[model samples]
Target: MSRTLVSALVYVLANGVGLLVASLVLGDSFTFTFKGFFVATLLLSVVEAVAGPAITKAAEDNVPALKGGIALIITFVGLLVTNFLVGGMHIAGISTWLIATLLVWIGALIAQIVLPRIPVKKAVQKARGKQPGKEG
Candidate 1:
C-alpha cells in the first residue's frame, strides 16, 4: 500500500479502537457516543494524510524533538481542518475536543511504531525501495 493509504487506515482504525475502549472504561457520556468517536477518527485520518509523512520523514533522520514538536502542531492543524470539513468547528468551551485530539495522536503514534514491524516480503520490500541487505 502507498504510505498515505496505509497511514490513513491505521490512523482511523487505531483511533476508533482507542475511543471505543476509553468510552467503555470511562463511562463518560461525552466520549461514549459513536458519533464522537467516529468524528475523532475522521479528524485523525486527515491529520495523518497531511502531516504524518513529514513527521515520519523527520523521525527517519532523527530530527530534534523541537522539530518533531512543530510537526505535531501541523498535524493538529490538519486535524482541525478535517473536523471542520466533516463537523463544524465549535469548541463548545469544553476540554473533550482537546482530549480527543490527544488520544488520537497517541493512537496514531502507536500505529506508526507498529506498522514498520509488520515484515514485508522480500519482493514487496524491493518494490517499496527496500533491498535485501540494505535499508532504504
Candidate 2:
C-alpha cells in the first residue's frame, strides 16, 4: 500500500481500537450504537488527521513547553469533535471523556506501532521456517 493510504488506514484502525476499548472497559460510561460507532470512528479519524498537526504546530510555536502533551490534546479534541460535531458517540461525563482520550491515544499508539509489525513478524517466521537450514 502507499504510505498515505497505509497511514490513513492505521489512523482509522487505531481510532476504532481505542473506541472499542473505551466502550468495553468503561461500559455504560462510554456507549454507542453500532452505526454510531462506525460513524464516530470515521469522523474521529478525519478530525484528528486534520487538527492534530495544526494543534501540534500551534503549541510548538506558542506554548513550546506544552509540546509533550500535544498528542493528548489532539486525542481530547478529537473526542470532543466526535461527540459534538457529529452524532454517533455518547461520552457520558468528564471522567469518561478523559479516560476515552487516554484510551484512544494508547490504542492509536498500539495500533500504529505494534499492529502492523505482527503480520510482518509472522510472515518472516513462516519464510524462515521454509528455508533449507532453518531451525524452529
Candidate 3:
C-alpha cells in the first residue's frame, strides 16, 4: 500500500478507537448503534483529515496559543460534526460532551502512537528472518 493509504488507515483506526473509548467510558451519555460506530468513525476521520491542517494553519496565524491544542480542537470538532449528522450516535449534555472530547483525544493520541508501530514491528521481524543465524 501507498504511504498515504497507510496513513489514512491509521487515522481512521485511531478515530475508531477513540470513539469506542469515549462511548465505553461515557456509557449512556454517549450512545451509538453498532452501525453508528463505523459511520461515526469514518465521518470523524474525514472531518479530522480536512480540518486538522486547516485548523493548525489558522491557529498558527491567528491564535498562537492554540498551536499545542490543534489535535484536541480537531477532535472536538469531529465530535460536533459527527454528533447530529450521524444517525445512530448520540451525545447528551455539556458535561458528556466535554468528557467525551478529552477521552476521545487521549484514545486517539494513544492510537496514533501505537498503530503505526504494529506494521513497523512486523516489517522488522520479517527483515530479521531474512538473515541467517540472527535471533529476534
Listing every candidate in turn, what is its Cα RMSD in Å to the true structure after a full C-alpha superposition?
Answer: 9.0, 2.9, 2.9
Q: What would the per-residue lDDT of candidate 2 be over residues 20-54, giving only the tens digit for each residue?
A: 98888899999888899989889988888899899
Clash counts for all predictions: 0, 0, 0
Residues 70-107 of candidate 3 have per-residue lDDT tens digits of 88899899899998799999999999998999999999
RMSD of 2: 2.9
Model 2: what TM-score?
0.87
Task: Mark the 10 consecutive residues where model 1 has the least summed lDDT.
Answer: 24-33
Candidate 3 regions with alpha-carbon error over 4 angstroms: 130-136
Q: Of the pair 1 and 3, which is ahead by TM-score?
A: 3
TM-score of each: 0.46, 0.87, 0.89
Evaluate all candidate structures by whole-model CA lDDT and list the values in order. Answer: 0.57, 0.85, 0.91
List, residue by residue over 67-91, the lDDT tens digit for candidate 1: 6466455555655665566542333
In terms of TM-score, the best-performing candidate is 3
Models ranked on lDDT: 3, 2, 1
Clashing pairs in 3: none
